[model samples]
Target: VDVMHAAFPNKVPYEIVYDRVVPSMPEKYKPLSRREFLARVMTTLLVPEEKWCLGETKLFLKAGSSLELEDLIALPDEEYGEALFKHLDLAEKKMAAAKSIILAMQAFVYRARFLRVRRGARTIQRIWKAIKLRRVWRAAAERLLEERRGRLAPKRE
Candidate 1:
């Protein structure tokens, strides 16, 4: 695990990512081995709203604590689909916040783009500020969800 961590620094999990994702493989998806690599990618891409400082990609490494998403992840199969849908709704709400921020910044930029040069400059500055904020918030949340999704995934790889 340390070897893999040394190689993949910011992307490696708590040395147990392989352990957890491995045992959860449902019978149908038991053919995966090295496929655990995908889990790391998913963690980087999917988790959002986790604990992160601005521009931080590796929350665990930065926090100096082992982060476990499996503890917070719950998979509601067909029998629990209702709860799953509710969780999806919650996710939508979170996305809406980010979307609105981006949209508002776009509007400001668009309106100023062809006006006065000073206005355009200010707009561009604001746009950059908004983008930085978005990156921080979005990446943090994405990291959270992706890290947590290990067990909630299809279980069969």
Candidate 2:
């Protein structure tokens, strides 16, 4: 309810959404009211229907629900944000090295007048060159976190 209120501040109810909003949706979509959307999201998207209940004035999750943010943050796992950054950095370096090799091979193929081979090499080269660039933002975030953690650690003689 809080999320819904924040998203739609004017307070568009289920009834209004059913009568007016649903009908105006694009043809490819099956229109569902705000109530239906909430029901589906809570039950199907977030968790099973048994995990949550629709009360008279609000929707509440059952006790011991994993849907709670605290529970989500409590789970022990690898720092995936850092892992992903490392993975992407390695990927970019590999891609750059591969591009250099492919370009050299492409020139060799062109000199030999291998039309089909050159065409394929050009396609591969273009794909690697056109790949999206990323700055490994997670590395910086992790470095900041480590600095903060170091400050909080106990110092020994």
Who wins the TM-score comparison? 1
lDDT of each: 0.48, 0.50
The segments of candidate 1 whose C-alpha lies over 4 angstroms from its true place after superposition are 1-68, 72-84, 117-157
TM-score of candidate 1 relative to the true fold: 0.29
Worst 10 residues of 1 by lDDT: 51-60
Q: Candidate 1 on 1-157: residue-level lDDT in tens?
A: 5433443334433333333444434443345443333333234334432432211223233332224333222433332333323444465576898899999999999877757787879999999999999999999999989877965886553
RMSD of each: 33.1, 32.0
Which residue runs does candidate 2 get wrong by more than 4 Å?
1-30, 66-157
Clashes of each: 15, 0
lDDT of each residue in 104-149, candidate 2, tens digit only: 9999878778877788999998876655222355667789898888
Model 1, CA-based lDDT: 0.48
Alpha-carbon deviation at 108 in model 2, angstroms: 54
Error of 2 at 93 (Å): 34
